[model samples]
Target: MINHILDHRYELLEHIGGGGMADVYRAHDQLLDRYVAVKILHSQFSNDEEFIEKFRGEAQGAAKLSHPNIVNIYDVGKENNNHYIIMEYVAGQTLKDLIQSAGKLSVSESLRIALEIAEALEHAHANNLVHCDIKPHNILVTPTGRIKVTDFGIARAVTSSTMTYSGTIVGSVHYFSPEQAKGGAISAKSDIYSLGVVLYEMLTGQLPFTGETPISIALKHLQEEPVSVRKLNPTIPLIVEAIVLKAMEKDPNNRFANSTEMIRDIKRAESGLLHGDRQNNAISNQDPFATQILPRVSDSLPSRKSNLAPDEKIPQTNLLKSKKFLWGLVCILILGFFAGAFLSYGKFWSNAEVIVPDVVGKQMTIAKQMLETKNLRVNIAETYDADVPAGEVVSQYPAAGTTVKEQRLVTVYISKGGEALEMPDVHGLTKVAAETKLKNMGLKLGKVEEEYSNEAAGTVLNQTPRSGTKITKGSAVDLVISKGPKSRKVTLPDFSGSTLNSIETQLKSLNLKAGTVTEVTSSKPAGTILDQTPAAGTDIAEGSSVDFSIAKTEKATDKNTNKNSGKDASKDTNKDTAKNSKPADAPKDTK
Candidate 1:
């Protein structure tokens, strides 16, 4: 499994992490040449056709959703016996890990994470999808403090069915909504309840409810009210605690209606907590997205689904019971027709115009509501934006505060966030040159690895997200650069007890050199080699030099010894002659 390449594309590199359901591995996508996290469903569940189909459906739908706080799903497939999902490879620690290490987080920090999670939920809920599981384990926090939610729908399909089949609640008992605990129908509010549990854990460093067994803990969710987060962690703000308690209400109806409502209240809590506002309930602080009933059709003509023109003559009525009844029906239809015409004409002339409020920076949901509130129709056009969040309008045609007739179309260019771009060709460029190109294209250099290649030294031989591949801006491109041909090497050969000329020949044979030949007279034969540097069997660069020393031959040592002996003998002879002549005459003997 470690080296298995799924679909002949994703090369499994190493197992990184996983939860109870899947074994996650870090893989390299050969087609795109990028790092991806591949989550393969465990074999235990492979035979469950119901679970597999549900998992596949959920993955498909989740893949369609794009949010800053949600980990992106790239692909999902079944390769033979393996069911796998390739997703955004986020380099971060799990929120659970962070909580374990930090114990309890600060008030502001907790809200920040919770708010982001809520935003993500709102996005998914808007698409009519619920993230059944919302816990610290499924949440990831980047080093930069950016929060991302993962396992959006996979957990939902797995837990719901697995619980049914096994009659055992799994890992998420601590965060279970009471309704979920009861095996009742679940909705977005159920997720809100789970989020409350997550928030409670974040603030208190422990689950709000716990018991000896999963079922018991689940029962606590169904029957027990958690200790106020404030009680567990006194530092938690009153508003924050209230928000948590409201979300974790036993009845789903008792919780925030949806992600939007929860987000609204969470924002209020955050503001009150941050500013220390006296009015902790700031739900009505301001809503960017506000709307009113606006005509879906043009204001010029009264909106009517029927094809019948307002001026068209009334058709003969069907008589029921008597002629008097038919005549009465005729009169009623004529009068009603005239009344509708007059009312539409009068209302068109009398209806007031509301200024198109500034909703450029507001979320699309809020902006649409604001437009509808003004009796204006929103016409959206999507484009990429880097400075603004996705779903925010880049610009409005009628502009802010512009007076327009009711039902007027406000052409809003909404942002879908940064547009993905095709990676450019950077092969054959030097390391510095390639990096410069990537930076210019709003990309970053990922990993830089060197390998021996025929390509020029330091030139890029290949790049991940190969040229012309569409990828989001700021995506790192791993590169493979050539370190030129591998360095040439030669092994040192033993040259001990070998003549200088002979050793030089041997070094040449090995594509090496004899560095220096030192001759000295010793018991070891001269020119027969005493020792050689780089002792033997050592690998070094081809043509590298090896130093050597050789002992002098015994014959040469003997010749020098005899010369010294002869000189000493001559000195002794002179001394003897001088001594013998000294008795006769000291001056004559010295001469």
Candidate 2:
């Protein structure tokens, strides 16, 4: 896919951002020689005829919305089956990534980003567009700290088109408005509700609602009230909290009428001024976008044709009567069929009581055999057992030696060793993290060693009990921490037409160590140092030596040695040379 773009007018350089719907690439506009962001519909959507139309339509609608705070759309194009929109490239990170990178930003910074986004929303609202998805992931903060909102009006536009089908939630479950979740009407206030969620996440470093499944989370958004932002961050102003609560109200009417009003309230709160009707009027007067556009309600399920028998077709008015009669007839026929089959296949016998066998002390295989002899099947359920031996039955669901049905299935719990604990994800974590996780898991630190590495200096790396290796709780594990880069003192060796060995000896006097040496063909002599360890200008302690090699004469031929030298030189040309061919004064090789 990327290869196709190399010859394109806008050359895609690298992928900068992506989401469930599309991918954003940093591209160079060959004609203008300027960078532009190219957002292309995901391949999965590109082939979807319905989604392709919606994607293109939404891009067009969003392109019409232009504002300083909003990312400007330049062009929309289709190359083969790939559909893409060119937009102004803003060099920045998304608010979500930034918040993740820097946990819980200061209140002021959070507010600043929020204010810019609100202003952008106000602009969108004025243009008769509502950005249904207003989460932090959609907001970008440039290097200069200026905030810009992308994907304006696209969600609503995409939702309205029947081509995209129904039941597909347009916004993130964590930030969706109650109406959106219920398949009810949406409006500008819906965006405000999403903005409230973003504010909550920025302040708390987490979403308001979370669950194992997307549906569960969406249901929570629809029915539950989020935790207060002030509760997460005490530093947040009361007015800010009020705004958030109001915006997050399940009732759309309860939220701020527009983003402009929210922005005004935020500013007033920051200034420590009480907001009132007059302030509302002032904010409303300044609002550039105040038009009301009712949102279209979407169905909970996409339209699907049910597979029904030919006899199911009935007039609309008589549908219920016909359905009830048909169902009753079918039920009676099914019941009679089952009764006849059972009577033909079974032998009726007198009720006989049998004692369930006691299999507690028996091995699982033997126990299964015993149960099978009595017309019982074993249902194995695995669980962690700290006190029970692995592969052994820990307990049985039904008490043994109890009378039951002949074909009754006995459920047994099997031991699978101790509960497997996942290695805590500790990469890029601080020393405090290592200690906290280790202690929480009843583990202790044995030894801490710091070494040089490109990773954060204090970050944990190699541990004695490597991650995922099961060990008893409270075991002490040695942790190795990165300590930045390695630093060493190297002695300076002189290379004034002296032998490489002599230079190494000089380096040894300075307390420096020697490394590999190489010989270069030079006219100086057969054994003269072209360079020395520690490079001549390096500072080093005394009593250290360096390995040195001399420049060979042009006439000297050692094919095997030269071949080896070439390979070594290719690996690293920093090897020291013999004395007398000091690089500083040695003539450049003519060959």
Question: Which candidate tops lDDT?
Answer: 1
Model 2 misplaced stretches (Cα beyond 4 Å): 161-166, 273-591
Clashes per candidate, residues 3 or more apart or on different chains: 10, 33
TM-score of 1: 0.48
**Mind giving the per-residue lDDT tens digits that candidate 1 earns over 21-83?**
899999999999899999999898899998888888988999999999999999999899889
Per-residue error (Å), model 1, residue 465 = 54
- TM-score for every candidate vs. truth? 0.48, 0.47
lDDT of each model, Cα atoms only? 0.80, 0.71
Worst 10 residues of 2 by lDDT: 344-353
